[model samples]
Target: MEAVTKYSETELVLLLKQRQQSAFSYLYDNYSGALHAVILNIILDTELASDVLQDVFVKIWRQINSYDDTKGRLYTWMLNIARNASIDTIRSKNFQNNKQNRELTENVYESAGSTQLMTDKIGLRKLVHQLKEEHKVLIELSYFQGFTQDEISKMLNLPLGTVKTRLRTALIQLR
Candidate 1:
């Protein structure tokens, strides 16, 4: 068996920035489990989360130069990248369509009595509906339907700042 190689965070960052393959391998071996768990928390689906995890690593590799050690720890930076990538994947149209298709297939297989269970699964929407009409619309468009703030702004003919402020206020209310 080959001996395991260990690197300090600084060493790992340096080697990674230098594009050393072994450093990347070591980084993956040490960090992927934690990163995968973070992504899985957001994405929920293992296959999709795995894909996001791969994309996260690719982003880490390519964006290593942009990483500033003075700003934060290496793992924290990677964690943010993994989290953002997972959120981006879930917010993507393809992921939403695939999710809806999967839900439809599952519903077809389920008995009629389970329809209520599916409806209950939409509890988040139910909660959002309790908000004022404007806030509700923003939540539905941005969270449920995965529309970006800019898209919501364009669709509602509102300024981007207003969209962001409303969304932030809606989230604060939800919390």
Candidate 2:
């Protein structure tokens, strides 16, 4: 194998679509650090960041064909995957237990942002944070963690009727 020179993100993505090892190597070498930074900034744990980085790359490799240049750049797509994975990992039961063990409880409601976690996310993080505790929790479970209403009800130990009522009330307040 010869040392490869520079290639634009588009060109590398094109090669990646063809499943070229060199292209994969180039993409990882060039963008891994940026993506890691994005994940680390959101998750703020070195070990977790590394794990999510690996997951992000695996997703990118598997879903490369889904990339569409007309929509956006390759890095943009990869960034979205990294952000979602980081948020997902943080929401996992493992993360919750780990937080309890470490005495460092994380609030899923508090991890919103404009760059790494949720850039331009409904333009409502700051506003949502100002909401009542019940509202904040409902929004976090439903929007941030991607949970359905029933799941949120079970997680919160609340009745399904209560969850629906709170979510509806929260939306009205937000509006």
Show the colliding residue pairs in model 1.
Answer: none
Quote the positional error of residue 158 for candidate 1 in Å: 18
Stretches of candidate 1 off by over 4 Å are: 1-3, 94-175
Evaluate model 2: give its lDDT. 0.74
Lowest-sum lDDT 10-residue window in model 2: 101-110
lDDT of 2 by residue, 110-164 (tens): 3532233443332445456667888877876675556789977877789999999
- Which portions of model 2 miss their true places by more than 4 Å? 1-4, 94-175
How many residue pairs clash per model? 0, 1
Residue 69, candidate 2: Cα error in Å is 0.9
Q: Which residue pairs overlap in candidate 2's backbone? A: 114-119
TM-scores for all predictions: 0.55, 0.56
Give lDDT: candidate 2, residue 114.
26
- lDDT tens per residue, model 1, 25-83: 98898889889877764455689888889999999999999999999999999988986
